[model samples]
Target: RRADVFAMDGDTRWPGGCEGRAGVWAQLRSSGDAIGSARAARWPYEATELEVLGEGDRRVVEHGGFLRAVERFDHRAFGLSVAEAGCMDPQQRLLLEAGYVALHGAGARRSALLGSDAGVFVGIERPDWALRNARQPLGSRPSVFSATADTISVAGGRLSFALGLQGPCVSADTACSSGLVVLHSASYAIRGGECGRALVAAVSLKLLPNATLGALFAGMLSADGRCKTFDARANGYVRSEALSAMVLAETRIGGGRLLAASAVRQDGRSASLTAPNGLAQRSLLRACLAQAGEQRGRAHGVEAHGTGTSLGDPVEMRALAGVLGEATRPVQIGSAKASAGHAEPASGTLGVCKAMLQLSASQWLGNARLRRLNPLVAESVPPGRAGGWCFPLQPGQDALSSAGVSAFGYSGTIAHCILGAGGADAAHERGAGARAAVLVRHSFIWYDDVQPLAQHVEAAEGRTALRSPAAGALLALVRDHAIRGRCVFPAAGYLEMARTASCAADALTAAATLRGVRFLRPLLLDAAEGLWIACEVVAASGRVEITSGRDGAEERALHSACELVGALAPAAVSKPALPRLRAIAGSAVCTAALYAAFREAGLEYGPTYQTLGGAWAGDGGSFSVARLRRPPGTSQGVLIHPADLDGALQLTSLLSPSSGGGGGGGGGG
Candidate 1:
């Protein structure tokens, strides 16, 4: 089965706590070491569990993964009552929040999902909160809400209900493979016409001590709480907590797409119930690759299900080597378990997310804590193949186009999925054909007048809207003001736009004072997109709001707002005396040194905004003379020059020179 993943998000509490996809990618690209000492608070009976396992000092199970602020959630925002929210499993809460974020990231709001044929598929184990609730006294039981809140089966239904979705809602539990299994199920449902879109989520939490005790008894957990996958020192996997969600659709929507998926059962013929079968894994990989058809060989790497087990790691490597066969270049393989610990049911989906990020960035992240390779696994593959098996210790560029993700359940269910870059086909589908050219016989017939503001202005009862093309003389000036390596519209430019609108709307020559001015958000200019700006004025209250967005988008973001008091009388236009300016000009501070200090603090000003020609400093306040480097032509129709205003405002830095806090002003004339 195949489907497009529009967006994905998650919250994780591995060695280093992270939230959302960007945070996770940052962690992976940087250290990729989220394994550390387990806290006693996470498992109160740590000592007792170790004693029961008969652990020696050299190999004690004293470490596990954890996160802070586990109990933090906003119940009111989700429309949940206090009592029901209290009884609800944290896994359920995480899925609900992350699902909402994922949908939003996909450019679909919860309102958009209402009554739509969008499915919800969740992969989670039995809730630890339910066990804790069962341990309570019968007399204090809140039976009505507990049934729906604590049950893992209702997790998908709860999300569907919250979004008013009408499509299939299914929850799966297949041990470690649960994440990828749900993903595979969602793809099939979409392909089968069961749902037009789907939200797939997986969550795992190490809340109670019993699960850890059971793992210790089964000899499944690592003693040092580190997953040294494909390494000789590998012993076992470390348990971690994670909640991840992704949105899938039939048509591509600016994200990675699944190429194929295959699942197989190992049966009970293996050496042990939990032991990985090489033959089964090899078959699974081949089946998945076969389903990918011509696109199979495009895969650049594999995200291995490396649990750090001595037997499991070797068997998986052999299966991978067998499937890869002879290749021009060795295929790189790594695992998220090495960096973030085994999130069990959530690990499979986490691997898929990592793969998507790798493809998007065209870079491969190194595995953490893999110091030495296992001799048996190294010997199984060819010399060249073995060399490519090891990933770099730091992030490096690779021509990544596709990736393979594997997840094997301890219960013998195995799943493999292939993901590829979907942008090319999407771009082709969205392509606009060449436009026909017009032929003119005479020069007089082809002549046209250019009226920049006249054609863009739209006037209504309360608002005056203006359109600014992405490319023009005004945008050229805006692009000249770069900050932090990006072309950002200056704060003074917003003030200028607001003032120009105020004068036109209120029938004034010029706005005398702007009160309670607030710069809410910066206007970031994109070369390919034009801007739509609206100035809404409340006549009675004198309130003005300036908002801007992409030309064709419905929603506009507020950039600047203020109260426009009417124009000043002719008598009040006289200049005041500047005694401080005269005194400080004699002992002026160097303008070059001041700009250098600004650069050190990350405020990069371009040639247009660097109009601070002469400056001065003193204890009272500080004074500066600023002038525009070149004349802004009259065709621009600007009431006041933004560059000159901005340069004058920059003089405020001298008031608290030593502080270097980079404070901003609230209002200005």
Candidate 2:
């Protein structure tokens, strides 16, 4: 369930004026034409009335993919004041709204994301809004929020701040390839332990006059205002206005997984600064296929960066053909630009969304408005190449299990990513034997009789035994709480295990408090194969121990030991007064500084463990506020969340800072 949304000016016959995922899909499924005459009411100046010179010929800028009401936004929904919203760039606004919709589709609500470790990666190029505001009347002062609102650098930060995300926030500008580049960066971040999950978004809006004029002067804009990609009549691309967003995470909750590999490369010293390099593109595609390991040569389709430019299309086709030409079946090649127009920086991300849709539906929407195949493109891939390029003239069904997507920047940066359908869906399509083999290999089914904590538990006499598969959602959550660049199981997780074992052994419905808990060693999780965990509890002595080892190993080393006390009675329950502690504290401690100190001490904490929102230190003691960050819809049926408990334990650093040299020292608990 990868959440995705798109705002485009598509066919009016569809519902909601082609404003959502369904609308874009419908447009592609039907006529596959979203390009149309530019509206006079949307732009500040009438585009159809304006003429521009391209290649010594004057052409009217009459066609584009413009949204019906790009100006509409609910300021209150995002907690922005009207004045601030007014000054905010429409790119920023659209990104925020689109991000919310995407997250919601992935089952992450606004309330569930507060203090999340999810990262934000946005790809945006032009500063049209900023340029427009700079041309205000003489003596006009810019608003205080103008810098933040219009600046492209802060676009990702704004979304992170609004969602209360505590992970990495980055904004990239790489000309038209910005979107794919950010997607590449996000995937690397997740793999490199930067964030547990990420939101990748890209937007393009033709709001200023200079952009259009510059493209026209550079002979980039299509005179006919149509992107005839791969067609003999292709001249250039028509600029489009669109925004697309999707969520990427390690969990299977999303629509699909990034095939084992993706690659990014740069063209050095080409014919021109903006010229496409066939060799560089070929190298990039090879690198991506190499990274895919055994999955290489399995691509069933490709969403090409077909800008409809005569030079670019042929070069890209040659590179693609050289790398993917040997497939057993014809690779269905097409471009969304043929229908939606070129969205510039946002084009790459939009192409990814479309590819995902095609993979999910097992279909390919052919090139729109393509009258004839470009002779150069045809010549690039020789007739003898196994199943050469096949550009569909209409929508058709194809078993697109995996697809490749490409985006190249005029700046010479090139990115390519391979995507496979969701595991369950792909396995299903591969047949029952494949599905069973995958289940046996992973040892976990998404929807099984197993509970969240432990998959199986058995109680005999006073001893309790429990076994849980260390993968899927549990693995995803554990990965978020990385320690020192490694996915180490948190101490709180041990407590959770101890409590669960005690309750099961004692036949108690309520969890028992753990006493004398000790983490003997760190449990490191492997990226390829996570080992299963085994817990043993002695109910009579209230003793519990947990351990894990390589699958089918002879011995399992102890990782934790604890004693579970009986559940507390109603009279024994007590609540501490945080306001009283705050009154006694002397000075306030900056949360950011505290985390920085922790990082310097090699106690790195990700977004889930970054729970100390507010802290204060004094001679008497230290007071702090901690918020729990976890996956959405996972807070119920638990005595205490591991993240919340770990956060509270982190306050120990404030009590004995000199031990770790991490600052915020105090004596009182």
Candidate 3:
């Protein structure tokens, strides 16, 4: 498949610990070497399992891929309450995370997805959350419905709802082949013009104790805690946890392509229901090749559904040998399951992701845990090419143009997909410029240690809501900024609030200029208790009003109002042209020292109020740069932050040194 955008989160040694497709791809450059004990000691259930299984058993070791930040969900990012998020499954949480990343990777704008015809197809098989909830005593807490967030159907529907997608939302389960099946379904929907874009996701989380025991009893789990794909030492597969997602759009839409998908089912019967049928796999491969409109020789490689099982590995290889034997080149072959462990329902998506990475990196990944090739697979190996996973590419090697991904469900259902090069640039190349953007480094600086503020914009009527918790903790500087013996929110705070709201609603290329401002009432400190501050876009004239009060159906006091001028303007480049400007003494002091100065001046500036930097008086006026710093648990966006403007405005009072007592209060507009 042409990977216009993909996202993955699994174990890896990347700088950020493999949170995205790039992270997974970087880890795939070499054989997976991150295998380790699953840390049974951390949990009583796993520890008990280990104790019962004994040291000699690989099940005791229980190695598999686990995510590092499973508990760290940004509930506010998805607009879910803490209670709602707690009741939700981690699998659903991960799907939301990965789906959003994939959409952004595909250059799909957030506004477009809202109320747009974008289908969502997700693969999910585990019901660990539901099982765990069932074991708990049904206490006073209300029962959580299986269809709410625990059901597989909600896995896709939740993402669609969160992003306001109106297309078909389906969750598929075909055992290990579920991932490919979901992806194949999404492709058909796109080709059939059912939706303009499709979000396909596969997620697997092994969280319950009973599931491990089931796999152990089923003889499907690796006793040695490794997936030795294509190796003689292969015994069984190791279960892993992962989230893989992709964004698909029709090639005619001018983005990427998921070339072709061919799914087949064993009509009669196999050696057993779980046993894979080689002939069925071969037929599926041929059908996939034909659907891709290419002969065996035209293919570049095959990402086999090699789970390292004693019986399954050989069956998959024999099927590949029979189908790819006629290819012109020694077709490269590999499996991500060897490195990342088998992600069950998500493994098929992981394999396709690996194929895309291989095409982009122009190198076939070496299968991990492969020391000795199985006799059956070795006998079918063509001359010149090593029987095991192919070696890494040397310099100047051409990248593979077409590849095949095969996933066989334990239920005797086989699915194979053929993907060819849709673009010269791989996933990395497509996002290189964005990945290297300076905004990546600076965009997060505006948000402090608080829940990010959500922006709601109705551009049709030129209205937006930038609602957030008030900066009560930032009353340090403004502690002395009072009018009539009452602390008043600084005028600059209003400006920053208005500008930020306007910017969020306007095009990213443009900024807002505040004018026609008026202050209706002083924002008293005590009046803000149990209240939220909001900046609302009032009209088509670009007017934004900052208000504070209780939630809906309550009167909100109008703290300040301003008319916003929205237009494309060149970035500020010219320095301030003034007669004379001087730096405020001790402006370069450390934060503590600056606070000490404020204390000496009897100006009790809190975190947000202490934004004034060096100040100077010259040419019959005073000037200073207000270095507004974000307060703890508060977020700001405008370069000319309200706090900064207030700090700078304070420079005017410096003209009268006697005003240092915080007594010279005047109107600012």
Candidate 3: segments with Cα more than 4 A from true spot = 1-16, 40-42, 45-55, 138-140, 143-147, 252-258, 264-268, 295-297, 381-398, 426-428, 432-669
| Tens-digit per-residue lDDT, 478-592, candidate 2 | 5667656777888888887777777677653444778887889888875527477878988678788898866767788799998877874656767767677667776767778
Error of 3 at 408 (Å): 1.5
lDDT (Cα atoms) of all candidates against the true structure: 0.69, 0.71, 0.64
Clashing pairs for model 3 are 476-605, 476-606, 477-605, 477-606, 492-642, 583-615, 584-614, 584-615
Clashing pairs in 2: 2-255
Judging by lDDT, tell me the better candidate of 2 and 3.
Answer: 2
lDDT of 3 by residue, 225-308 (tens): 778888888888877777787777763222243464545555248788888888888888777777666532266778888899
Cα deviation at 110, candidate 1, in Å, is: 1.9
lDDT of 3: 0.64
Candidate 2 global TM-score: 0.60
What clash pairs does model 1 have?
A: 15-34
